[model samples]
Structures are given as C-alpha cells and as structure tokens.
Target: MFLAATTAGDRVRANPGGQAFCPSCMADLIPKCGEIKVWHWAHRTDDCDPWSEPESQWHIDWKTRFGLQNCEVVMGPHRADVVARDGLVIELQHSHISPEEIAERQRFYRRMIWVVDAGEFREHVDLRLASIRTDPYRQQPTTYRSFRWRWPRPTHARFTSPLFWDFGDGTMLNVRKIHPETPCGGWGYLWTKPQFVRRFAVHVDELGDALEDGATA
Candidate 1:
C-alpha cells in the first residue's frame, strides 16, 4: 500500500551514499553497522541479527523496550524504511522526508516517521507534518460484562473494536449497543421475575403495533 513515490520497484540499488534494501521486505535501510561491518545490510528480524548503530541521519532512536518485550523497530510492508505499530505510528518529532511523500503515505497507509519541531532535516526539504483527523481503527480483542441497572450505574461501556461507532460530532459513540435486551429500564425487572414476561409480551406487542401503524403513513 505504498504511495507511488515510495514504490519498491523504483529503489536505487546499492548507492554508496548509504542506502541498502532488505531482500525479504524490500525496505530501504541506510547502511549502518558498528562493530560488525560485514552485517551492515542484514535484514531486521524479531531476533537480534546484526547490531546496526543508530545512524545520526535517522534523527531518532526508534528502538524501545516495553514491559517484558522490546519494540521491534523494523520495516513495515514494502513502503517505509522504518515502522512500528500500536495501531499507530511511533515517530520522532523530527525526521526528514518530503511533504508530498508524506501525504502519499497517508493516502493508503500508516507509517512511523521522524519529526522535528522547527529545523529542516534535509536541504530544501519542504516537509511539515499535516494535521489530519483520522478515527483510529481499534484491532484488539474486546472484553464485555453484564450490567445491572437496579443499583450501580454503568462504569464503562463494553465494546469490541468494530462495535464502536464514530458519531460525526466531536464525540464518537457506538452506533449500536449489541445486547439481547432492547435498551429499556424494564430489562432488569423482567429478567428478575418470570411473571414480568407476560407484561413484557403485551408491551412489546403494543409497541410493534404502534410501529406498524406509523409505517403505513
């Protein structure tokens, strides 16, 4: 999903100026290696392969350790040189890339970029971070709990990633709350007492009839 400018097939091959390609992922990595210069162009894997000293040109040290795991600062799909996903891009406040290239990346992708507050990264690099409002697509498993309206109010709404909705307003609420109980106050009472089912049936029947009447006109 790379923008046309960052397309893989158009890469510069073995430029002495310091750019190399990862054979497996085709990400353009700058030639950076410290003690073991021979492994300068090794592909980045989850396992420690080669220790490439953080290049000054990278603008930021993207490698990070969280909890018991280390953040794998490797390349993403065939487009960007560096990548990290929290379902979001992790980037420094200052990295050098063209503005056009950045916009194109946003068109069909998500990327971690180096960002700088004020100074330019490369000469004549008219790169500025553009502010685009994007609703984050949550991609993790969701947990749910049953609520009882008889006493305590809802502490939090339980929703899976896809279940939530963005209500065009500044506030985004779930379009629908998927519970067997049609949102109503009688839910708790009826579930508590079997006799209430009789009354509930009549109520639902009347409500259905009202809806049917409304549909006619």
Candidate 2:
C-alpha cells in the first residue's frame, strides 16, 4: 500500500505487456484498475511475486544508464523502499511518494520511467505477451510494456496508441499530432496529464510520409 499511501498521483507508469508480476502472488496478472499502472500491481490469485523491493537490478541498471545520482531507498510515502534521484521520485511497482514531495519536486525535473525486467517473468510467459493483447495465458506477466509521464508545466512530449487496419501494409496509417488540438480522425489522440495538449496517434501515415519525404527535419 506504500504506492497508494506515499506517492499519490506522483505520475504512474504502466506495466508494459499489459500484465504485472505480483511479489505476494506468483502468476500472470490482469491489471486491477480500469486500466494498468505499476503502482496498482496486483494479482488475481493470492500468491504472486511482487515488483516490491529496494527494486530489481533491471531498474537499477535503467537508473544508472539514465544518470540518476544519490538515490534514496524509502517506501512510497509510508512503506517499503523507493529511490529518488535528482529530485525525480522512482517507484518500483508501488513505491509511492508524498504530496509534499511531489509539490517540492515539481520545480525540478519530474521525469521517471517504469521498468520491466526480462529475467523475472514466468517460463510460460510469452515474450510477445503485450502484442498478444487479448490472447489467453496462464502465467503471471513481468515486463515493462507501457509508459506514463507527467510534467509540472506541461512538456512537449506525448504518445499515441498504435493504429490497425486492412491496408496493404497491415498497419494503421494513424496520424501525427504535435498537440491535443491537432485534429485526429477516427483514431484517438493521447496526451499525458498536466499539459493535456501534447498528443499523437502512433504510426500515422502522414507522419511516416513526412519523414519519408523529408518534411520533418
């Protein structure tokens, strides 16, 4: 509960592969909330291997590679352990931070990336679990599938869900959006919280064409 207790709204990251590995229970997972966020890591069964810890070595590697320094290991706000680097709060699974911490850290860089370790999944866990989408599986999942980001003053960063279709390429021609106001047709445009303007539709044919035609510098 440290995740919920400590870092309430401290920016949540999604369990990539659309699944999580519960430390308390060992099995494949279905996200608890209406959607998935690492802080909401849980298992349908009672016994699951949690993403809890000082944090996994994979997460450590990600931090080091990304240049995190003087990190502290404390539970979200009221539990276990969390790592905070350069004013950025790093929560593994449910490592939550306090509202005060969030407000204070807002002035600095508010960036964090949730991680999934390839070595920790079940034997039955498919490497393509994320791509499987609606397929059936028996093992609990462990992989960083999706990412959620937040910024204090609103950043120019954004992402869109991939598009699908029956065109010659079998890929959806989506659309390119620099911001939420950019006008996306049938496909949806996604924007991170706070700014709520930076949005995009992944793999848009327009973007692809722009890149191919060298319209994008």
Q: TM-scores of all models?
A: 0.26, 0.21
Across 7-72, the per-residue lDDT of candidate 1 in tens digits comes to: 443422223345545443555555433553322333344312222222232222222111101122
Residues 74-140 of candidate 2 have per-residue lDDT tens digits of 3232221223333334433223434444444333323432222212222322212132122111122
Off by over 4 Å in 1: 1-23, 26-54, 57-60, 65-85, 92-95, 111-114, 117-217
Candidates in order have lDDT scores of: 0.27, 0.27
Alpha-carbon deviation at 152 in model 1, angstroms: 54
CA displacement after TM-score superposition, residue 43 of candidate 1 (Å) = 8.2
Q: Who wins the TM-score comparison?
A: 1
Candidate 2's displacement at residue 21, Å, is: 32
